[model samples]
Target: MAQPTLGIMTLYLSEHSGVEERSYFRKVIAQAEKLGLRAVVFTPVDVDAKNKRIHAYVYDTETGRWSRSWTPFPHLIYDRCRYQDSERFRKFRRFRATYTRLVYLNRPISNKWGMHQFLATSARIRPHLPHTRVYSEHADLTAFMRGRRLVYLKPINGTGGRGILRIERQSGGHYLVQGRDRNRRIVAPKLVSAKQLPLQLAAWNVKDRYLIQQGIPSKLPDGRVHDFRLLIQKNGSGEWEVTGCAGRVGPKMSITSNLHGGGQAVPMTELLRRRFASEEKIEEIRKAVYSLGYAVATEVEGRFGRLCELGIDIAIDPDGHPWLLELNPKPAREVFARIGEKETYEKAISRPLEYALWLYKQHYGTSSSRRRSGAGKSAASSTR
Candidate 1:
């Protein structure tokens, strides 16, 4: 019998810039091989629906190397392509529409606003979300800021905490606008009022295609703003499970806790203990975060589709309340590495492979065949 194959797809893969990411694919390839599955790495350009084949770099476990070859599309696909290029995105759509039968671990959710709207359908997940609204008119911005002291204006399709602005209401009824500039440096605070908001916002030249969300005051003992990044993945049983989590402390005077924004990783439990005096309250908040993370993973997929994993960002307010900041389909494993949690990082890397194996067996009926074959036949086949 031919060994089952698993395909990992990304965008414009090259050995030069793919140095860090290639190590991850190699690890998954090795682990998948252990489960009697072959793995290959490819890009959208490598796919050829016209010929029913993909020219991919297949990982050979025998010699531990990658070699390019043409083969049929694997039964399972792990879509990691961000579709940064508009043209590449159109190609992905054509391929996906044709290969509708191939199993996908996680379907990419591009627009943050779209994901929020889907998640808002569930009452259970709605409260955990910060109040969010589309930004069109300056009137809406002023009205939202009127109720909350601080609100964030974020791009609808932004990632890595880029293009985010923190608008805060200051004393004497003035407003302060500060954020990371396009050059990735912290911008100077600008003062404005309700009357000046329109002109000031127009000066920035980006009031369209964004969202205004109420900001939660999640601060450390040292007064640095931070948020939690909790990793959740599906297990071998195909159930949602919390894999790993860490505290992302933002840079001084910055708005986001993104690693790209000069943020540092720290122990989440220790941070909670330092922020909250009572040990019992700290434990309570920890449990809540995990529960909320699991809920997000499940509810998001319930609305969207099957997701192999998610990185859920959470904010803990001063009152010990946890809010869902955002959920990431492509959660970076580096955060766990920074926090010195090697075990959790390895687990985070391994769970997707395990889930893929589970999906393979479920879709192919391998488990049931073994069950019906009994122990003797199963052992006999394994040795063969």
Candidate 2:
């Protein structure tokens, strides 16, 4: 019997073939080998389109090294490609379009604004979402700021808290603006008047590519902003389950609590304990947060097709109400490891592989009779 193959699709971070999650891919490939599966990592640029083969990076367990090999596309693909602003990303788009017949474990979801609108359609999930609108003009921002004391301006397709601005309405007709630039550099807080607010943000070009969201109050006693990241993944039985949840605390003077932007990862319970005095209240919020995680993942997969996992960013208000902040399709699992949750971190890394094995069996049959089947074709067509 032959082992099923899984291709981990990713994009080179640099012209020199730098991959962002190299170590992580090594871990995934190593795990796949142990589970009777063969895995390879490749980007679109490495594909030999004419030959229908990929020049992929494969892990050698015995030698503990990576080597290149020419191999056919795997039985399934795990798309780990993140957004890149270069020719590599353009190649990725073409690859996805040209290879529609290939089976993928997960497909891309909509951006922040598009996703927010779609989630808004679900009556059960709508209340958990923060009010958000696409930024088009000064009037749009003013309209959204009418009653809200704090608002956030975020790039529609931004990740890792890049290009996010925080606006706070002051008592004396003044507004304070602060954020991280596109480079993830912190922009110091500035006080501006009502008339000067638009001018301050002119450089961001917020009209078409940004979203204005109602800011949830997440300040702690030490003045740092904090939020929770809940990870949900499909188990071996192909059921949605919460793997774990961790809390993120922003550094001083930072508006967003992104690990890439100098934030600290903490245990969810530990952070919740700091905010709520009663254990009962903390437990209630915990339950609500997990429930929201399940609901959001289920709804998203129903609309966007099959998904292996999702990292949901959630905010808990002073009243202990959970609010959905954002959804990350290609979320990093380092947060769990950073917080010293060894068991959860290991589960986070292996759950997707387990799901992959389950999917392989369902699609390709048992090891004795494993072969290319219509399940891949049907799944691919459905995504299209």
Best by lDDT: 2
Q: Give all TM-scores, in the order shown.
A: 0.88, 0.95
lDDT of 2: 0.89
Residue 205 miss distance in model 2 (angstroms): 3.0
Q: Cα miss at 247, model 2 (Å)?
A: 0.1
Error of 1 at 14 (Å): 9.5
User: Model 1, stretches more than 4 Å misplaced?
Assistant: 13-20, 59-66, 83-85, 181-184, 193-195, 366-384
Model 1: pairs clashing at backbone N, Cα or C within 3 Å: none
Q: What stretches of model 2 exceed 4 Å from their correct place?
A: 366-384
Model 1: per-residue lDDT, tens digit, 146-248?
A: 7689999887874678778888888888889988755457876899886786787776665678899989988676767899999999887677788877999
State, as a TM-score between 0 and 1, how close model 2 is to the true structure. 0.95
Each candidate's lDDT (Cα)? 0.79, 0.89
Best by TM-score: 2
Model 1 lDDT at residue 367? 65
